[model samples]
Every structure is written in C-alpha cells, then in structure tokens.
Target: MSKKIREKKSTLFSLLFIAAVILLTLWSLSRAEDPDKLIKDIQNASPVFLVLAVLCVLAFICLQGVVIWLQCRSLKLQESLWRCVLVAFHGYFYCSITPMQSGGPPIQIYDLKKEGIHISVGTLIILMETFLFKVVLVILSLGMLLFGHRLMRRYIWPGLFFFILGTILTCGIVVLIYLSMFHSGLLRRLILWLFRKLEKHHLVRSKKGRVEKLISAMDKYRAAAGYFRNQRKLAVLLLAVTMLQRLAYFSTTYFIYRSFGLYGVSYWTIVLLQAAISICADMLPIPGGVGITEALFQVFFRDIFGTMTIPGLCLSRGITFYAQLLFCGIFSIAARVAFRVDKSRLGFFQTSFIVPEDAP
Candidate 1:
C-alpha cells in the first residue's frame, strides 16, 4: 500500500483506540459513586506532585532519546540530538496505537534513515535498544516474582495469568534475540528451512530469491552485533542506561502516589509492583494495554490506594499512557516540520531483506 493510504489507516486505527479508551474510562467513571466527586478529588491533587509525575514520564522519553544519541555516537552516525528526540517520540506514537506496541520499529528505522543513517545500522541500533530494554524488564520481573511472590499472591488470580504470559513472551523474545545476535548462522538456517517448507506448500513465492535475501540480512545483523560485542564497555554502558530508562518509567507511580498524599509505602515496593503491572500489561494484545493496565492498577494497588484507587489509576494512566500518546502526537508533527521530512522518504510498511549498507 502507498504511504498515504497506510498513514490514513494508522490515523483511523489510532482514533478508534483513543475513542475506546475514552469511552471505557468514562464508562468506568460512570459506574463510580459520585463520579463528579472523583473528578474533584483528582482535580484537588497537588499540581506540584502532578508536574513531577509528568516530568518523570518525560524523563523516560528523554532517556530513550539519549539511548539513540549514544548509539549514534558509538556508530559514528551523524544524527542530531533533536532528531533523536523526534525519533523517540515517533516510535512511541506508533507503539501506543498498535497491538502489543508492535508498530514502533519500522517507522523508527525510517526516521533514522531520513536523518541520513543507513537502514542497516538503524535496524541494529533499534534491535539492541529493544533487546536491552526487554532484558532489564525481564530481570526486574523475575526479581519481583522471586522476592514478592507472597505479597503478589494477594492480587494473583487473573493478574497472575497475565503476569505469567508476559514473562513467557518476554523470555521468548530474549531467546530469539540471543539467537540472532550470537548464533545468526543457526537462526538463518532455521528460518530458511521454515521458508522452504512454506514455499514447498505454496505458502510463499520467490523461494530462492527470498532465501538469499534473508541470508544477506542475517549477515548484516550479525556483523552489527559483533561490532557491539567488540565494544564491550559501550555495550555495558548502554545496558545500564537502558535500566535507568526503565526505572524512570517505574518511578512514575512513585510520584503519582506521593501526589495523592499517599505515602509510607516504600518506593521500591511500588516500583516492584509497577514492574509486575508493566510485565502483565505489556503482554496483552491491546492498544496501549488500556483496560488491562487500569485493571492491573486497581488490582495491585487497591490496598494502598484504598478510597483513592480510582483517582490514582486516573493519574497514573493519564501521565504515563494517555499523556505520552498526546505528547508523541504533537512532538512527532513538530519533529517532522523541523526536520523537513520528505514525503517520499517515509515508506509504507513492508518486510524486506536487509542489503549491504554503505557509509552514512
């Protein structure tokens, strides 16, 4: 499909999801006793704490931008800081709208290519970024599961199902990434074998051509992985940076909690819970994990949030999820305007074989 048509579809899908979220939230609020009072309670929340909570969310975005900048510097790519920020926002825009946040990478790579980075390098950068983020999230999830199993059991029931599923999903991705990075040849062989079967059964065309292209792409990706492996210190530093990025997101709950005069709960405890909530929410195939996320918030924090539970959900989801959606929408336009992104350069979605790269 053409880029224009694809963009229209994306816009429509995003609007639909936004509408669903708004309607769901309203429906939820309508069921609450004295919905106006709940709004009033949220409105009465301290502006200072609310602002801090937003800043934390922005920090999370900024840290992602920093990751791109650091990766560019390491690769000697000539992308500017502002462009990196824009790319981060662009990724978030697509991620928030799509199921399981799956629409992020292609547009992100396209944006990087617009900034004059080679597509191959951009792909590797994003792959590493995603890998590191998931690794940290999984580690945090496991740590929380191991240490807080007893406390978590109180909220187990349905949330536990999602939690387990999310962990399994994350672990699956981690394994695939490991294979791609360290055992690319084996990955390439397995993929080729699968493709051959599909072709044999008339499931795909261009069998030989596609297989050759796939092998080429895997080689490029493996080479990129090797580059990072050789830069061991830089790789380690990026891992630590990514961990902080995750923490910044987790800390959003802490600020929101404090905003409501809800205190005495250990921040780390909240962070752990936030990690679990995130793990479960991320696993769901919902746009922004909208309903699931809110439900998880209520289930996990009911004891601490008590009467303020609804308001707390409103604030937390507002700042971290919906607010970022709005931010990405506005900033993405601004970035495109500032960068003068060419219409033709913005390609529509397609899965292609990665070819050999030239210098950026």
Candidate 2:
C-alpha cells in the first residue's frame, strides 16, 4: 500500500476504536440500577479522595515513563524524561482501546523510532518492561491468593476460572520471553520447526524470505537480551520501578473506597482485592477489559461497598479507565503534533538503519 493510504487507514481504525470505547463506557454507566441515585452518590463523593485517586493514576503513567527513560539511559541514549512520559501516555491511549492491550507496544516502538531510538532496542525496552510488570503482578496476586484465600473464596469464587486462566496466560508469556532471552537458539529452532510444519501443510507461502527476516529479528532480540543480562543493577532498578507502578495503579481502588465515605475495609484488603481483579482482567480479550473489569468489580466488592456498589463502580471505572482514556487520547494526539512540528523545524532526515556498535 502507498504510505499515505496506509496512514489514512490507521487513522480510520483508531477513530473507530475510540468510538467503540466510548460506547462501552456509556453502556457500563447505563448498567447502574438507578442512574439518578448513582449520579447523586458519585457527586457526593469526597473530592479529596477522588483527587488522590487521580494522582495515583498519574503516578502509574509517570512511573512507566520513568522506567522507559531509565532503560534508554542505561543504553547511553540521551532522551529526556518528559519525552518518555509522552511515550507512556501514547502507549496508554492505544492500550485502552485495543483488545488484550495488544496494540500498544508496536505503536510505542513506532513512536520511539520517531524519537531516533532503533526499533530493536525499543522492542527490548518494552519486552523488559512487560516482563517485569507481569512478574511483579504474578507475585503479588499469588501472595494474595495464598494468604487471602478466605477472601477469594467468599467474594471472588464465581470468577475463579478467569483468575486461573489469566495466571496461565501471563505465566506463559513470561516463560516465552525468558526463553527468547536466555535460550534464543532453542526458541528459534522450535519456531522454525513449527513454521516448516505449517509450510508442509500448505498453510504458509514465501517461507524462505519470511524465515530469513524472522531469524534476523531474533538475533537482534537475543543481543538486546544479553545487554540486560549483563546489567544486573539496571534490571533490578527496573523491577523496583515496575512494582511501584503497579501498586500505584492498584491503590486507585483503595482511594476510591475511601471516597465513598465507607470506612470499615483496610487499605491492604482493598488493594489486594483490586490486585485480584486485575489478575482476572489481564488475559481477557475485551477492549480495556471494560465489561469484564466492571463485572468483576461488582462481584468482588459488592459486600464491601454495600448499597453503594454501583456508585463505587461508576466512580472507580470513570476515573481509572474512562477518564484515563480521554486524557491519554488527547495527550497522545497533542504529543504527536508537537513531535511533527519539532521535526519540521529541525529539518532532520529519518534514519532507519541501526549501527552494529550501537546495538542494544
């Protein structure tokens, strides 16, 4: 396809995705048993706690940007913190609209390319970030599942199947990444073996060219992995930042619980419950896990929120997901425009080649 045609199609798809997210948000709002009562309750929520909840979300975004910036710095790249934060907002915008959050990393790599970061290096950064986040999330969820068994049995019993599925999927991805990093040859052999089987069944064409490209990509990936393996301090720093980022996000639920003026539940309880909800939501193939997330919130916290369950859902989902969608969407567009203008003023040429010495 022509370049301009491809750009237009991408823009069209993004607009359609945004529209779908808006409709889903509205549908979730309509699910409240009493719309008027829900509105009243939300309006009456403590502004102080709501603002804190919003700050937690901001922290989540900023911390992710910090992680990216740190990764770039570790590689001796000279990118600024603000620019990296914009990259994080860009990621959040796409992730919230796409199913399984699958569209974010590729688009983020494109954004990073515009920033003069090579695609392979950007891919490695994203891979490490994802790996750390999932590892932390699994650790936290497992802790909650083991210690808070009664809590899970009491409230989240119905959704136990989803929690298990999400755990398996998350762990599977982590294992695949580990293999790609430490056992690239074995992984390459396994993948090519599978590809040849499909080829034999006449399921694929142009096997030679595609296989060559795949091998090249895996070589770069393996090189990047070696960089991380050698930088133990940077790896540990990234893990710490990832854990804080996740906790900042999970804390949003606790702040929302406080906003409702109901005070019996401990902060730890609310945070762990939110963590459990996140585990169940992570592997679902829904856009932003919208419907499933809301349903799980209602199922898990129905007793804790008492009669205010629907209102809490509205407020919590509104701030964390819908409001975030709006903010990140606008920020992504503004940042893209700013980038284009800056590029135009600088009159720089785009360089797509990666220097061997600069690899990783």
Q: lDDT of each structure?
A: 0.79, 0.78
Q: Residue-wise lDDT of candidate 2 within 120-198, one digit each (tens)?
A: 6678888777788889878976776788788778887888888888878888878887776677779779888998888
Q: Candidate 1's residue-wise lDDT over 190-237, tens digit each?
A: 888998899888888854477776766676676666677788888888
Alpha-carbon error at 55 in model 1, in Å? 0.4
Error of 2 at 346 (Å): 15
TM-score of each: 0.87, 0.84
Alpha-carbon runs more than 4 Å astray in model 1: 1-3, 154-158, 190-218, 338-360
Output the lDDT of residue 302, model 2: 91
